[model samples]
Target: MKLIYVFFFFCIINQTYGQQKELELIHNCQGRLSGFATVKVIDKRDSSGKQMIGIVQKGALNKPVKVVFNGELTDSLAAFFIDQSANSNPLPLVLILNELFISEAIDNMTEIGRFRLSLRLFIGKQSDQYSEIVAIDSLYTVKGLDVTKKLLRSISEQFCKISQLAAEKQPILDTDAEKYTFKQLHYLDSLEKMKLPMYQTDHPSVGLYKNYKEFKQNTPGVTAELSIEERKNGFRVYIWDEKRKNKTKLPSTGLYAVSDGTTLLRATPLGFFKILKKGGDFYYWRPQVNKSHHSLVPAAYMYGALGGLVYGLIEAASAGNNKWLLQKINYRKGSAAPVSWTTAKEN
Candidate 1:
């Protein structure tokens, strides 16, 4: 009875003192970068010299370009930048802003109204998020650059600040199933329906295996078959091992990513692929490079002529043609490696 009382007392003391509980680890997230995607609206001058608005629902920039926001309100604007961030490597976050708007504030600069140059930023990363309306720079004391230049500078500066925050905070990310959210719901709906334009490959269908035995009959190591099934309207990936007699199915989205070492294009190039080397996030594969003749400029004009030629060829041989095999994607950059096919076939 005495021992029981002593144990109960100890338990009560522990609870009261807030001791013995395991400490929760707070991961510091770092890295901040900002890229600009053009907004889908058009601005034009009317016959009367007044500004007009046009809408291009399916328009976008060739690629996401880096943007910098300058002036007094840079930090406030950048607070909304979003990008690909992982907890393990948090110092270099690059948030690609899909839509940027710089409004005309001349209409309300009176005593009762302050027409400060305000801005709005929107991003699409499987979710939608935007920054609140903040008055960064007052038009009354504007500087050398115009509204467009100021907006870009401010946006970029905001990103640098976020990078610093990531370096200091190191916020950890949850798994795909964890459903971590940083985006606002209003833009999320628009982002979900947005899809980039892509190219169709010559070889659309690439497989026909009913089961593991059917696909694993004669492959060497880990055999993966990627195919586009037109009838089912889905892309499929199958993986199997010869010795273990086991198979695993990886998720697929009915399309293959092709690249040009500078961009990621989509196409189903029907050819055998190998598991060359695996990296932390990307499966490196040989991309096809086409050395097409752009107007023959002097060697000196194109990277010092002979030196430039050698450099281009070498680049094509290395990262230029290397493509990333991702879990999912719609529109990829042109920075893909060259395209090529090998003879490592599957059963």
Candidate 2:
């Protein structure tokens, strides 16, 4: 009985000390970052160029430090920004806001346990924005004036790290289109060789069609056998009329192919292409690089030149005229040449 009593006493002391530590962390952060605690809306623009209104708890000088909205409203807005499925329950915007504080506190080396405990005390019981702020104010007892400078210094350091990481990952050029064209050609070739029936809604088909009805009616087997052959510039796609026993040229679309040394990006003709080396998988389109605009110009120009030359050679080679190929080539200009298919097949 005496041992049990001592254990209970120690447990209570530890709990009390933990509560005190949590309070200290909250006090430190709230005091320092109170000035920077303005509410910000993510992706607030609408089609009419109006800023979507949010529920605001006004601070001094017409600023807002706390914002409240129906949980459904916050979820809907969050879904729009993150492309996540809409949430049915109300989510506390303060929880999201407090993450910014938590991130700052962590950078300052405020013990992780104490920082998390403070956030729990501040917002855990509340499910909406106004209630959360009120809860935090009541639990932490933070006076607006008692400022903590160290927390703000930590936040500035964290922001700098984020900026540096973004800069390091920036691309050198826009090569997505060229890369995408190659993949599409590869996909078309694979489908033909495997004798896989192209589905009506397949990415390549939908990309090539201008109208929905035309896209719907043109079955794969009925139309030409589409195949792609690779060359130095880009790729040459052949549309063969099986009924006519002949091949014809399809309109060529310009593509952009960008590489980060590890990943290849292609955007053009049909859409975006993304090829990651890890899975050995290929895609047709990818998002364009937007952050490092000025640094990419020279590399983009070089890729464009290389892509054009490759595309031209592939087009000529696919046209299947040895005489035409010879006429175009300076070395073979004076030499009589046999048919392209005979030479190509022999080699």
Candidate 3:
């Protein structure tokens, strides 16, 4: 059929010219920005030193391509913002790069790509004395063979949106913002770190980790009567009472996540999902996001007991105070190292 020929032609075009082995995060802005006085970028991600953001796969026959910045990530992003700010203003700003990920895959004869970006914006008179003005957690999706073109356009849009966000929130920076210098912030962070319960990896307590920090430190916040039940089609989480010998069904309302020593399960309104992959600073959730109930049947066992949930997986990141919650993660099919959970859903 003509449609089959057209699909193969586009696939070949995408393989030959549309998707490159490596993609850069360059922003071709329409005009230079005049919002911030100075733009500084800090690499604060767990994988800050790594330049590779993610991998892209167009088809089964095509080899997965590694997507990295054209140069060093921090330098590249700083230059990107600075280039946008040709004519500066008066607000000194620092942009902390928390997460940057890009992934592409072919599903149902369509090539789907995702860009997951997270940044924390700070502003003040001095770099060290800046206060966080806004946190940008963004997800973008592009379909078809022109993956590179659409991704670049999305990056430009994100850049402009970030500039607009900073300008709009400038009033907060000028008024009630709590400023922290590098020294003060470091001291505070150090104090908080000292307070973490001493962890012995060999002798980790068994139970559900309330967040990623607890799992990383080998400490489970809730250690009482935790058990996972495998049902006919799915599973159920329960807490056993020692005194009464009764099992109470644990609700997923306030529950964020839980880990059974090795595998980390992302808790959701639907059920639990195994976070089996990680790219850059995040963990990848299986089965993608927002798929119907049929999608779960194929990976139901892999999900570790997701009943009939419509929504797929969750992305979790560490927030201070030993807490971790939803955050975007890059998805790749394969077993990954243990630690935390993440997903590629828009938040």
Residue 273, candidate 2: C-alpha displacement in angstroms: 7.3
Q: Give candidate 1's TM-score.
A: 0.20
Better of 1 and 2 by TM-score: 2
Candidate 1: Cα lDDT at 284: 27
Which candidate has the highest lDDT of all? Answer: 3
CA-lDDT, candidates in order: 0.27, 0.25, 0.52
Stretches of candidate 3 off by over 4 Å are 1-20, 58-62, 83-87, 126-128, 145-148, 167-176, 183-224, 227-256, 259-347
lDDT of 1 by residue, 168-224 (tens): 442233333222134333233234334311122222123332222221221112223
**How would you encode candidate 3's per-residue C-alpha lDDT over 1-347 as one tens digit per residue?**
44554454345435643344555555555554556656777765544325556556533233344555666666656655553344565667777665666666556545577877777777766444767778776678999744755765576577766766676675354556567764554333334334443222323455676655665565678876567765542356777787847988877555545644554555656566554333322353333232122323433343334421211331111111112223333121111221222333222
Stretches of candidate 1 above 4 Å error? 1-283, 288-347
lDDT per residue (tens digit) for residues 1-347 in model 2: 44553454344334432121111111122212111122222221121111111111111111112112223432332221221234311222222211222111111212111111111111111222122122111111111221233332333343333223322332213433122222232233233324322121233331233322232232222233554554544445545675848866554444223222222233345432342221111223112111111212332354454433433443344343211110000010111111111112210
Q: What C-alpha lDDT does candidate 2 achieve relative to the native structure?
A: 0.25
Q: Top TM-score: which candidate number?
A: 3
Error of 1 at 252 (Å): 16
| TM-score of every prediction relative to native | 0.20, 0.20, 0.54
